[model samples]
Target: MQQSADILKLFEESAIAAGRVILDIYRAGAAVRLKGDTSPVTEADEAAERLILAALARHMPDVPVVAEEEVAAGRIPDVSGGRFILVDPLDGTREFIGGHDDFTVNIALIEAGTPVLGVVHAPALHTLYLGGAGKAEKVKLDDKDAVIARMPIAARLKGASPSALVSRSHNCDATDAYIRKAAILERKTVGSSLKFCMVAEGVADLYPRFSPTMEWDTAAGDAVLRAAGGMVATEDGAPLTYGKRLPGLRAFENPPFLATGRPSERG
Candidate 1:
């Protein structure tokens, strides 16, 4: 229990530190570059990843790390032990570049292919979500990254008409069709893993993603949601697992999944 608590603390601190680096770059105006996958990356992402990787190495050198920018640069580490760190230094790069406040910094610890500890920090929004040590909480942070208040969070019970959240950048016809079939009462679009955090906090009831995503992209938020009495699962109703590899991909990727604040409504 103590060890899990320590790791959770490490994740929260590292996420906040990375958020600082990201916010600095965001303020100074970041330079954008495109990855081979045609995805946009910025100096903020690289610098934040460096800071987060260094912090994780200093605090937990034995644990392997699989970070987005590092993996994109071909720094795939051995994660055969089912325990490793996942970092998405700057999630929602497009939103960040567009001066939107929805981007976030994600850090998670996956053990036995399940996220056991995680932290998601939105620097511009001054919000942080943390899960581990048998609890989940949403924190309000100040401009200097100091925690102002924190309160336990949990997913709401399924209602007559549950709200649904979708990706702001990748909302396609398939996602729309799924939401329509679910007969959701309302819909909200958000960037980054905030969609998961919203469900974790009971602000939204469901988030279904039909598009491709990486493990690091969702693990932290997944941890938070699960800790908050929610769940993320594949379309087949199996829990989402990390450390996945596709046939031709060296990096970890996620299959299509659904995140729900009300587990009973998952069906």
Candidate 2:
């Protein structure tokens, strides 16, 4: 097994490289195309995925990679060993296309069905989150994608009237209803895996997603959150596991999950 520091560094470098590619496309106003599922894809997504996949192949050839654009193009690899890397080269594609700054590049290492290391970089926002080796931290990035400053981060224990983070683009009535039922003190709508990072950094208390999400969408942020003393669980209160596959179907799909900074409270 690779040392946690090595894995974390690899993930950070891959995410930053991918983030640079994404920002270049964002500035150029990338053209969007629809996939078979009707989800929007952009040049930024493909370019970033290629960059990340190449970096991983060079540094960690023994590990498999399950990347978004590749899988969408029918490049599925065998993940039966439950160890691999997950990449969402450009998560929140809709947000990116809409010119929102919440999109991110996510890279994660999954071992035996658990996310062991992760790095999430928001190029437009100039923010990055890293988690692994029993620690998590948030960093400020420069325009050139260099780290300016960083501070360790952890989830805050929930108090009375906790806040919640929800998807700004994919918001549904079911989520709103859940927030109401939880007696949430506040609700903030943001895009991409940043929701998970928010809880990890104590910016928010809870993030519940009742809508559809793939594992790549959540794994990296889930790793960061878990490393920061948070938890991501299914509706049945089970921790979300990776390397999931259906018989003769798509692999690494995810079920509805709830992420919380404070497992003790329901908000």
* TM-score of each predicted structure versus truth: 0.96, 0.96
lDDT of 1: 0.90
Clashes of 1: 0
- Model 2, 1-267: lDDT tens per residue? 678899899888888888888888899899999999999999999999999889898989999999998999999888888788999999999999999999999999898889989999999999999998989999998988878998999999987778899998888888888888888869898999999999999988889998878989999999999999999998888889999864544567787788998666633
The worst-scoring run of ten residues by lDDT in candidate 2 lies at: 245-254
Residue 232's lDDT within candidate 2 is 95
Score candidate 1 by TM-score against the native: 0.96
Per-residue lDDT tens digits for candidate 1, residues 58-87, read: 889988999999989988899999988899
- Against the reference, the lDDT scores of all candidates come to 0.90, 0.90
Q: Give the TM-score of candidate 2.
A: 0.96
RMSD (Cα, Å) for all candidates, in order, is 1.5, 1.6
**RMSD (Cα, Å) of model 1:** 1.5
